[model samples]
Target: MAEQPLLDVEQVSKSYGPRKALDGVSLQVGRGEFVALLGPNGAGKSTLFQLLSGLFVADGGSIRIGGLDLRTHMTAALARLGVVFQQPTLDLDLGVAANLRYHARLHGLGGRHARERIDAELARLGLAERAQEPARALSGGNRRKVELARALVHQPEVLLMDEATVGLDFASRRQLLDDVHALVASRGVGVLWASHLVDEAEGADRVVVLHLGHVLFTGTPAELVAHCGAADLAAAFLQLTAGGGRHAA
Candidate 1:
C-alpha cells in the first residue's frame, strides 16, 4: 500500500470578485517529498499557497495537513506547517538570534528552552557566525537563511515556500533549494516550493503545473517531460500549459 500523503488538497477553489485565483486545484505530497509548484505569473500558484497557509480561506473544497482538515481544525493544521512568504519578514533592526527568539515566542516557546532552540536553528542554517548582527546588515542570501531558520524552529511537518528565490543570485538560489530539499529528505518534511523557474522544478520529487487558475498536470518530472516530448522543463511546461485539454508528447 502507498504511504499516506502529508498534504492533500481536493477540489480547492478560490476567487476574488471577478478574478478566479484558483480553480478546482487538487494535489498531494507524500512524506519526505519535495514537490515544486510551477506556473507563470497569475497562474494561481501563490494563491494556492495562501489558501494552504491560512492567509485566506478557499471559497470551496478542502485542504488537509497530516489528515487534519484546515477549515475545521485551523490551529492544528497550522501547527504542523511552516511558511516562508515571498516577502522578507525579518525585523531589520533586530539581530538574527533575536529574530529567531521572537519567532519561537510567537509559537509559545519561552525561557531557556526557546534560547537553546533559537541557537540551534541558527547554527543549522549556518547563521551562527552572524547571529548577533542586525538583519539589515546581512547579505541577501544570509537574510534568506535567517528567514528559513526562523521557519524551522518549530520543526514543522510541512513547509510552504512561496517564491523564496525570486531575487536570489544563481548560487544563492541553488543553495536555498538544496537546503530545503535536504530538509525534506532528512526530516520527513513535506515541501511545496512555488516558483516559475523551470530549472528549480526539474529535480523535485513531483511537479504540479498550474495555468490560468487551474491545475494543468501533476506527475514526476520525467513523466511531464515524456508527456510533452520536450528537450527541457521550460519547453515541457509551455507545451502542457498552452491549451486547455491538451497533450504534447
Candidate 2:
C-alpha cells in the first residue's frame, strides 16, 4: 500500500469579516518532498500557513497532518508539525540552545534525549558554535537559522516555513534554502515553504501558486511555466497574477 502524505490540506477556507483570506484551498506535502507555496503579498499565503499551524481553524474543509485530523486530533496533528514564521519568535535574551530546549520540552522532549536532538539540529544548521550565544547576539540571518534549528529539534514529520527568507540578503536566503533542502534529503522531512520570491520555488519538487486567495496552479516550476505559456517562471508568475500583485524584492 502507498504511504499517506505527511501533510494533507483539503478544500480549506478562511475569511475576515466580508473579505475571504482563503478560498477552498488544497495542497499536499509528501515525505521527503519540498513543496513551495508561491504567492505575492495579499495572496493568502500567510492565511493558509495559519490554518496549517493551527493558529486559525478553517471555516470549511479539513486538514490532516500525518493522517491525524487537525480538528478532531489537534494535539496529535500539531505534534507532527513544525513551523518557522515570518516574524521572529525567539526570546532575544535566551541562549540559542535554551530557546530550543524550551521548545523541545513543550513537545515532551527532555533530559539527554532532548539535549542530543538539540545538539544534532544545531550542528546540522552550523549553529553549534553559537549554542550558548544569546539570540540577540546573532545576526538577523543567523537568528533565522536558530529558529529553523529550533523548529526541527523535536523532529516533526512536516515543516511549514512562512515567508521564512523575508528580510534576508541573497546569500543568506540561498544558504537557508540549501539547509532546508539538505534536511529534506537527509531526514525526509516534508516542507511547505511559502514565499513571494520566484527564485525560491525554482528548486522545489512542486510549486502551488496562489493569487487573491485562490490557487492558480499546482505542479513543477517547469509545468507552471509551460501551463502559462510564458518565457520563464518570472514571466509565468506575472501572467498568472495579471501583473498587479505586491512582489517582494
Candidate 3:
C-alpha cells in the first residue's frame, strides 16, 4: 500500500460571494517533504491558507491533515497541523518563553512536559539563550524563529508557513528557509510553505505553482524550468502565470 501523505488537499474550492478564490486546487505534502506553494500577490495563496487554518471552510472539496478529514474531524485534523500566519501574532510585551508557554497551554500542554518541549524547541531554534528577553527586543529573524518553535512545540505532523519570510532581510530569509528545510529532514515534518518569491521555492522538494485560484504547475524546480522551457524558476513562474485572472479580495 502507498503511504498516506501527512497533508492532502484534494480538489478544494472556495469563494467570497461572486469571486472564486480557489477552484479545484489540489496538492499533497508527504512526511519529510518541503512543498513550496509558489504564487504572486493576489493569487489566492492567502485564501488557501485561510482554509487550511480552519478560519474559513472551503465551499467545496476536502482537506486532510495527518489522515484526518478536516470537515469530519475539525479538532483532530487541526491538532496535527501547525501554522504561522503572515501577520505577527506575538505579544511584544511578553518574554519569549512566556509567549511559547501560552501557546503550549492553548493546546492542552502543561507541566514538566510542556516545559521540556518548550526548552527543546527554543534550543533547536537557537533561541534558548534569549528566552528571558521581551519579544520586541529580538531581531525580526529571531522573532520569526520563536514563532516557528512555538508552532512545533505540540509536534504537529504538518507545518503551514504563510509568507513567513515577508519582513525579513535577505540573509534572514535564507536562514529561515534553511531552518525549515532542516526541520523536514530531522523531524520528518511535512511542510507547506506559501510564498510569492520564486527564489524561495528553488530548493524545495517540490513546487506547486498556484495562480488565480488554480494550480498551474507542480514539479521539481528543474522540471518546472524544463516544462516551461524557461531559463530558470523565476522566468518559468512568470510565464506560467502571465495571463491575469481574478484576484482574491
Query: After superposition on all CA atoms, how large is the RMSD of candidate 1?
Result: 1.7
lDDT by residue for model 2 over 91-147, one digit each (tens)? 999999999999999999999999999999999888899999999999989999999
Per-residue lDDT of candidate 3, residues 48-70 (tens digit): 99999899999999999988999
lDDT of 1 by residue, 145-238 (tens): 8899899988889999999998899999999999998898789899999999999998899899889888888888998988788987889998
Q: Which numbered prediction scores highest in TM-score against the true structure?
A: 3
- The candidate that wins on lDDT is 3
Q: Sorted by lDDT, highest first, which candidate order results?
A: 3, 2, 1
Clashing pairs in 3: none
Tell how far residue 85 is off in model 3, in angstroms: 0.9
State the C-alpha lDDT per candidate: 0.89, 0.91, 0.92
Instruction: Determine which window of 10 residues in candidate 2 has minimal summed lDDT.
Output: 240-249
Candidates in order: C-alpha RMSD to true structure? 1.7, 3.3, 2.9
Supply the TM-score for candidate 3: 0.96
| TM agreement with the true structure for every prediction | 0.96, 0.96, 0.96
Candidate 2 shows a clash count of 0
Name model 1 segments beyond 4 Å from true: 246-249
